[model samples]
Target chain A: MNKKGIIFIVFLILLVLHQDFWNWDNANLVFGFMPVGLFYHACYSLIAALFWGIVMKVAWPTELEEWAEADDSREGG
Target chain B: MSTVIVIAIYLGLLLALALFSKTLFRGTSKDYFVASHSIGPFMLLMSVFGTTMTAFALVGSTGKAFERGIGTYGLMASSSGLIHAACFLLIGIKIWAIGKRYGYVTQIQYFRARFETKAFGYLLFPILVLLVIPYLLIGIIGAGKTIAGVTGAKITPKGTIPGVFPEWTDNGAIPPWFTGLVISAVVLTYIFAGGSRAAAWANTFQTLVFMVMGILAFYLISDRLGGLGAAIEQAKESHKVRTLSSGGEVGTSQLTFLSYMFIPLSVGMFPHLFQHWLTAKSAKSFKLTVVAHPICIAIVWVPCVLIGVWATGIFPSGIPSGAILAKTVGVLVKDPIIVGLVTAGILAAIMSSLDSQFLCLGTMFTNDIVLHNSKKEYTDKQILSMARGFIIAIVIVTYIAALLLYERSVFDLAIWCFSGFAALTPLILAALYWKRATKVGAYSCVIAVFISWITFFTMSGFGGEYFVFGGIVPAAIMWFIGAGAMIIGSLMSRPPSEKTLAKFF
Candidate 1:
């Protein structure tokens, strides 16, 4: 798949994970104390950070670079 | 040190930072408004992150989780983690580019130029300000309440009101009116000194202070509660614990949980965030913000949500939800210094956003209203002075509003403000990506949002959980109506000029 396609799929998964349709009220504790649902989101946030990093790398717009350069040159001139 | 003294020292330090930044300011309107677009990557990340996590994330989230359960995390944190970062990646970058390309200092300036109409700017400025004032008020109110709750006299003889305060306040806490004025004045000083540059600097410092202090508060509070394990055990036994059998799925139904996801999308339309994004030195400066904002959100929000949830176990009944965070701290920690630092941390989180919101509104008024209409060529000095003047007026207005609405909870007021802005997200998204978006379409979109927002606000009594047509949030209706208006109204009117199309495309 293309990078854009991969980004879309990852974001879709993130969205699906965000919905609390499963055993969110599960009283089962993770790591001795943390609730399972709460733990799931803690991990989800980490994965989101990683996912956005990938988006920045793959989908970072080149026009922004050009704009920045143009701006720098204008200031310099 | 006493709690009052500690808080005073912290505010003094912040004022010192603000005054220090003023000396660094170059005398220009550009320097005042956007820091001459010279803010670095680290500062951008801090300022953006700080501005986003307000009293809502700290004091309000803790209060909310005390009332609800762990599901509060699922409602805001999980969705906010992804949605806020996604907005930075998609919306922030494009808008930064447009702002840079067109010399735009505010969202109104960008929207006016995008749709090629002055009337759109006139219409938009007020709607954005109306939504943002409530947001500003929430911060002021939250700070006042946090301070009052922490400092409420523990051993009041005969339950008499404190001698300094009016008879109305039976609790010996410092009046909300006093805290509001002090906070408003301190914030106004820095923003007045250096405008956006000072705001960015102060937010960066304040964000760091709050994050470190927040984590410390969490550990200290947990230790005082006799370790994390004991706290959890107590939580399990608490009557506030969520169970599927009792229909208490953490104080929210399945539909309400799902609909709560839409609230974080409000970041996409935040005028303060727009101003922050434009302050970036380069497009690359946003990379840090986009990549790390979710991590920062998780870091700050996790401790707050957990502390609030744990409070349920500690005080199973009778604590007012808004006062739970400070109340928990007051009960758990005995040392005055620790209590003082914790209160400072809460205030830091609250004030960090206030400065940015005040500066953004001032920048908007100066650029879109004052300069846009002025036939006389104003000097940069004049423009800078005008921005500062507008900020002073706004600070006073917000201070008064915070006093009038002191009885409201931070969580509810903040949700109302976020919902109003979130309903207008469709308009912004269309402006950035949709070629056919016309001036008429933007106006119609604004009208649609106003009508839906007012209808829902009246029905919900300004701020409450009111769902429509099978538990869907009122915001979803406003969102769809606004989007539909933009599409249909654009088609009804003439399409945007090819000249405008050529610039964006």
Candidate 2:
């Protein structure tokens, strides 16, 4: 499934469980006792951390060759 | 008999672990201070969480909740947790990135390098030392109090020297000096032996002990209150569910919310928390730790809040609102074994936070300020020795401060420490995110925060006796002014060199 589809399913599940569209006080319904607010906060932090990790993983310089090239460019400048 | 033996074994195991880690201590500067920057995710998670939890969470947070009702949870838990997560997301990643790039071991190094001003570093270093020392004293004193209270050991009253160490008392008793001495000895011994690495490893064990105890306390307390449903019912009956309740007029709630927001944001900028971020093995480790932190928070804090609420219903009279819950727990739990375990758990929370704070403050003073400005080059061994020396000095000074100043609440000490960082964080964030931010602006921002926080804190002390407004109002105003000065100063001044901008951005 697409990302949008996954998000939609999660939202629907939360809505059905909570029975209160977006109200914090009434949104205590994930599993038996845990609240949606709690889950939301946890998931938000995890996703943000994961996204940043991906960025750093992809962008960080690799290998001695790359370091030498970057150093040469700096010297030229 | 089994319970007492279990408790004894646990303490022995902790001491053994401290000793075992000591063998790994090569006395090199890096190994002593930051574990040679080889800490893993599990070590990182435990150390950071353990240090942040503190004795304040165990005693002060619950006591405050009992006094102020459910709003205290919002102030201390949900808002604080969310802001901490945000800090990791926004500023923590950047701190790790820059720290690695510059090979910066301490937060002060970052400040010194970024501003390109050793003078600025000199000024900022003392502020950290001054604000953080009182907090260390609170940690030391809190542990002492918990040890005495739990062990049922006799204590001398404040300012009184007993003829000898008195026997255990069942009823009301005096405070203990021996408690302080014992706690100090344990902390100083390991920290002196192994430095930051020892503290970090011990913190991992302590964090586990604290989490289990907190969970157990919740279960026991909830059971005593009949169940979770019954506890909520009692809390509601006691009028403890008022999250938006105001102590005074209309603006009080708004002011309280603003203070909560600002205070939590300051957590990221705290010197010790910064040290934790800088020591991560990889950016990936840092990210994982941040993501996992909320689970730790939930486990640690939710139980404390529940216990606070339960205490409200169980003990409605006799005790004052501020210390009602703690006093109630003292009365209800007559089992010596359980009480001892509870007390140790509380001390674990306090010591875990205190040792981390002491190490961070010492490193900043020794490594960042003193060593940076010295003309003579020193080896890593020399630097490590200086760092350990500073830790001892900080502990001695803070102990003296605690003895001299006797009436400040732990919460007050905590917030005062936070105000210093709260004033500095905005400018730090701007410098990281905004390419146009200049050195001139950064310097002015520091100056503005320094002058404003000091002035407002002083004025509030004088004004609190008569003025209608809370001190937080003036503090909020000062933070904004400082932030504004930084932005405006940058706009008017020469932009930073392209190379400098590229290094950070």
Q: Which candidate has the highest TM-score of all?
A: 1
Q: Each candidate: what lDDT?
A: 0.81, 0.62
Which ranges in model 2 have alpha carbons more than 4 Å from their true place?
A: A1-77, B1-12, B151-175, B236-240, B243-255, B317-325, B407-410, B462-475
Mark the 10 consecutive residues where model 2 chain B has the least summed lDDT.
B462-471
lDDT per residue (tens digit) for residues B1-505 in model 1: 2888899999999899888999989988888888888899999999999999887677777877777777777778878889898888889888887777767788887787779887888788888898888778788888877777666656534553242233546666778888999999999988998888899999998999888887887898889878877777777432223333364434666677777778888999999999899889998898888878888888887888788878877776557677777778777886778888988988998899999999989888888888888888887778878988999999988898788878765456567788888889988899988999999889999999999999998998877677888667887778889999999999999988898887776
Worst 10 residues of 1 chain B by lDDT: B236-245
Clashing pairs in 2: B55-B350, B155-B174, B155-B175
Summarize candidate 2's per-residue lDDT along B76-188 as a digit string, tens digits.
56555555666775687677666655666676676665655557666677776776776787777675555444444333344432212245444323244555555556676
Model 1: share of real contacts kept: 0.54
Report the number of clashing residue pairs per model.
0, 3
- Provide the TM-score for each candidate, comma-separated: 0.94, 0.81
